[model samples]
Target: MSLIKFFVLAQLKVEQFIKETEGASGIEYAIIAAMVAVIIIGFSSSIQNGISAIFTKIQAALPAASS
Candidate 1:
């Protein structure tokens, strides 16, 4: 019947759409990762400076040697 054929065609289209979307998911994740990487890279110098300051403070808090 034509109704059965239409239903089959609709199911096939839905399946194809799902498959295409599945493939796109990887690309979406990769793009998000890349954006995060860029943000980290941009802030790397500030992060490094903060870490360095923390270590310096820690060192300064220690007792001085009697040398």
Candidate 2:
């Protein structure tokens, strides 16, 4: 009888552990989002410079309007 009770308790503990681990998926997604945000922030200056260069080129190619 004692052995049976021990097994039941062990099973309950295992179930609790499984339930706690279910949050891991959410944590994984949060980690991925943070990494992507970090990467974007790291490249932001380069992206801005590229965009600025493209616009400058376009402006230079356009003829100035006469007054």
Candidate 3:
């Protein structure tokens, strides 16, 4: 009976340990932050390209000033 009780307590402890979410939250947040960084980097490159194209067109449209 005592041996059975020990095994049961051990099993419960293992289950409780497995169910813990405290340490996992940090990992989840890190993954989310990494994803956000990747998205921002991708968007910034496209935005920079678009702005550069617009400036190039504007520069081409305006005539050069005399020195």
Q: What would the TM-scores of all predictions be?
A: 0.63, 0.66, 0.52
Screening candidate 2 with a backbone cut-off below 3 angstroms (N, C-alpha, C), the clashing residue pairs are none
> Worst lDDT window (10 residues) for model 2?
58-67
What's each prediction's clash count? 0, 0, 0
lDDT string for model 2 (1-67, tens) is: 6999999999999999988977899999999999999999999999999999999987877766432
Q: What does candidate 3's lDDT look like per residue over 8-45, in tens digits?
A: 99999999999999999899999999999999998998
lDDT of 1: 0.90
Error of model 3, residue 2, in angstroms? 12
Candidate 2 local accuracy as lDDT?
0.92
Q: Could you say which candidate leads in TM-score?
A: 2
Tell me each candidate's RMSD, in Å, in order.
Answer: 5.9, 4.2, 3.8
Candidate 1 TM-score over all chains jointly: 0.63
In candidate 2, position 30 carries an lDDT of 100
- List model 1 lDDT by residue over 1-67, tens digit each: 6999999999999988877765688999999999999999999999999999999987887755433
